[model samples]
Target chain A: MIRKIFVIFAIAGLIMMLLPLVVNFEYKDSLNELSSQYVRGSIDDLKSQNVVTSVIVSYRGLDTLGEVTVLFLATAGVGFLLKHKKNKNSLRKASELLQTSSSFLVALIILFGIYIFVHGHLTPGGGFQGGVIIASAFLLMILSDINLKFNHLILHLVESFSGAFYVVVGLIGLLLGIGFLNINIVPLGNFGQLFSAGAIPIVYSLIGLKVGAELTAILNTMGGEQ
Target chain B: MTLTIIIILGVIMIAAAFGAIYFNKLLAAIVSAGVISLLASVIYLVLGSPDVAMTEATIGSGLTTIIFLFALNKVRKENKK
Candidate 1:
C-alpha cells in the first residue's frame, strides 16, 4: 500500500514539474536562423529538394555514418548472441494464401524499397526507411517458409562492400579538398531531379544497401539460421 | 479538424500504452506496443513530418514487433523443452 502511494506521489510530482513547461510552450511562427540556413543551403547549395535529406546525408553525414555503425554493431551483437543451429524438421507449412500472396507481393515490396532509397533526395523516405522496408520483405519470406535458406555469403558481401564504398565516397570528397562526405564531387545535376544532389543519392543508396543487408542477416539469424 | 484527430490519436495511444502494461499475454502486449507506434506515426504525419512518420511506422511498428515475436517464439520453444 505504501509502495503504491509512493508511486502515485512520484507520478504526481513528475507531472507537476513538467506542467509549467507545457503551459508555457508556444509554437514558433517561422523557422529559426539555423533551420532557415539549412533550408536555404539545402536548396541553393546542395540542390536537394528535401531539406531533411540534405541535413542528414550532406551537412550531417558523419553523424549518419555513426548511426549506421551503431546499427552494424547491433546486427553483429544479435548475430553473435543468437547462434542457433537450423532446425528444418520442426517447421510447419504456411497457409496457401500466404504462400501465394507473399510470392507476388515480395517483388513489388522490394521494388518499392528500391524506389524509396533511390528517390531519397527528393522524397521523405530515405536509406533507413527503405532498408527496413526491404528487410520486411525478407521477413515476409521467412514467415512464409521456415526452411528457406538465405545465402549468408551474399548478405555479408553486400553489407561489407556497401559500407566500404560509403567511406570511399567520403574519402573522394576529402581527396578533392571539399571536406569529408561532401556531395559536390560529382555534378549536382538539376534541382528536383533524380540525378541531382551529386553524391547524396549515391551515399544514401550505399547506406540503404548496407542497412538492408545487415537487417536481413539479423532476421535470417533470428529465423533459426546460424 | 486536425486538433480533433490529434486528440483522438493521443487518447488511443495512451490507452494502448496502458494495455501494453496491463496485458497478461506477452503477444497481446507486443501488439499493443505496435499499436502505439502506428498511432504515433500517424500523429507524426499529421504534424507535417513525413520522414519521421515513415521511420516510426516501418522500424518502430513493423520490424520491432516482428523481432519481438521471434524472441517470444524462441522463448516459448525453450520453455517447452
Candidate 2:
C-alpha cells in the first residue's frame, strides 16, 4: 500500500515538473522578427532554392565540414574499438540469380544517387543523401560476398584530398573578400544546370565521396565477421 | 477539429517518447524511440517549424535510427559470447 502511494506521488511530481511550460500562452510572432536572423538567411546567393540547403551547404558550410569530420572521426573511433576483434568473412556467397541481377540494379542506383547529388541545389537532395546511397552500393558488394579488395591507400588518398580541398575552398573564400564559406565568390552558373552553384555542388560531391568511403570502410571493418 | 486531432496526436507522441525512455529491453527501446522520432517530426511540422522538422526527420530520425541500429547490433554481439 505504501509502495502504491509512493508511485502515485512520484507521478504527481513528474506532472508538476512539466506544468509551467506546457500551460504558457506566449505569442510567437515576436520570435519570428527577433530570432529569424540567427536561424534563417542566405537563400539567394548559393543558387540553392531550398533555404535550409543554402544555409547548411553555403552559409554555414564550415560547420558542415566540421560535422562530416566528426563523422569521419566516429568511423575511426569505431574501427579502433573493434580492431582487436576476430576477423572473417561476414557475407556468405550470393545465389547465382541474385549475383547477376543485383549488379545492374547497383549500377542504376548509383547513377540515380549521382543524379540526386548533382541536382541538390535545384531540388531537395544533396551530399549526405547521395553519400548514403553510394554507401549502400558498397554494402551490396559486401552482401554479395564478392571479394572486391579496395586499395586502402588510394581510399585514404581520396579522403585526404577531399578533406583538404574542402578546407582550401573555405580558406580561399576567406582570402577573397568574403568570410569563410563565402559561396558566392565563384559564378553561380545557371541555377538548374549540373555545373551550377559555383563550389556548392563540387563540395557536395566531395562530401558524398568522403561519406561513402568512410562509411564503407567502417562497415567493412566493423560488420565483417570480426 | 484539426487542432484537436493534432493535440491528441501530440499527447500520444509524448507518451511514446516517455515509454521509449523508460523501457528496459534494448530492441524495444530502439523501436519505441523510432516511433517517438517519427511523431516528433509530425509535431515539428504542425508547430510550423519546417526547417527544424526537416532536419529532425532527415538526420534525427533517419540517420540517428540507422546509427542506433548499428550500435544495437554491436551491443547485441557484446551480450553474446
Candidate 3:
C-alpha cells in the first residue's frame, strides 16, 4: 500500500511539472515590437553584423554591465571563502604527459580565445564565451604544473583597468554623444569590416580581459591549497 | 521529426538526472550531473539558441565539473585528516 502511494505521488508530481509545457505549446508567430526594432536598427546604429553582439554590447549594455559586476562579486566571494589555507608542500606534481603537452596547447587555446572576443562584432562569439575559454586554458596550465604561479598583482591590475576602461568608454559616450554606451565615439568605418563597429569591439575586448582575469583569479584562489 | 528527437533527448536527460542522484560514488554522481548538463546544452542547440547552448556547454559541463571535482578533493583530504 505504501509503495503504491509513493508511485502515484511521483507520477502526479511529474505530470504537474510538465503540465505547463504541454499547455503553452505553440510556435511564436512574430517578433515583438522591441525585438523587431532591435533587429532592424542594430546594424545601422552599431555597425555590427552579429545581432546578438549588437544587442548585448550596444543595445542592452547596462544589463551587461550589471552581469559583469555579478561575476566579479561571485569570484571575490569564492576567493574570500576559500582563503589559502593548505600547506604549500601538499600539492603533488602533475603527470609527465600533462606537464609536457600543456605548454604546446596553452598558446593555441589563449590565441583562439582572443580571436573569439576580438571579432565579437562580426562573429558568433563575444566576450563572455572567449573569457571563459581563456580561463579554461589557464585551468589546464594550473592542473599541469602544481608549482606554477600567476602574478596576482598583474591579474589584479588587468581586471581593474579593463573594468574601469569599460566604464570610462561609457562615460565618454555620455559626455559627448547621444547617451551612455552610444558607440558613436569612433568612426563606424564599414558594416562588415574588422574595425567597423566603433566601440563594440573595444568594449567586448575589455569585458573579455576583465572576465578572464577574474575567473583565473577564482581558479587560483580555489586551487591555492596554500 | 524535431519533436521526436526532442522527446528522446528529454528522456535521456531525465535518466541522467536520476543516475546523478542514485550513483553510489560521489565522483560518478558528479560526472552524471555533467552528462545531464551536456545533454541539456545539446537540446538548447537544437532549439536554435546557440548562444545559450555555448554558455551551458562550456560553463555547465566544462568549468563546473572541474570546480566540483576540486571541491570534492578538498573535502576528501579534510576527511582524511
lDDT for each candidate structure: 0.92, 0.72, 0.89
Better of 2 and 3 by TM-score: 3
Model 3 C-alpha lDDT per residue in residues B1-81, reported as the tens digit of each score: 778878998998899889888889999999988988898888888887777787788889988998899899888878877
Query: Tens-digit lDDT track for model 1 on A1-226?
Result: 9999999999999999999999999999999999999999999999999889999999899999999999999999988888756553565788999989999999999999999999999989999999999999998999888678888889999999999999999999999998999999999999999999999989999999999999998888876543
lDDT of each residue in A1-226, candidate 3, tens digit only: 9999999999999999999999999988999999988988877777788888899998899999999999999998998888858454565689999999999999999999999899988877889989999999999998998878788899999999999999999999999967998888889888999998889999999999999999899888876555
> Cα RMSD (Å) per model?
1.6, 4.6, 2.8
Docking class of 1: high
Each model's DockQ score: 0.89, 0.24, 0.59
TM-score of chain B of each: 0.97, 0.77, 0.91
Q: Candidate 2: where are CA atoms >4 Å away? A: A1-19, A25-44, A87-101, A144-151, A190-195, B1-25, B39-63, B75-80
For candidate 3, report its TM-score.
Answer: 0.91
Q: Model 2, range B1-81, lDDT digits (tens) per residue?
A: 558868888788788778888888877777777777777877777876565565576556655666677777767767664
Residue pairs in collision within model 2: none
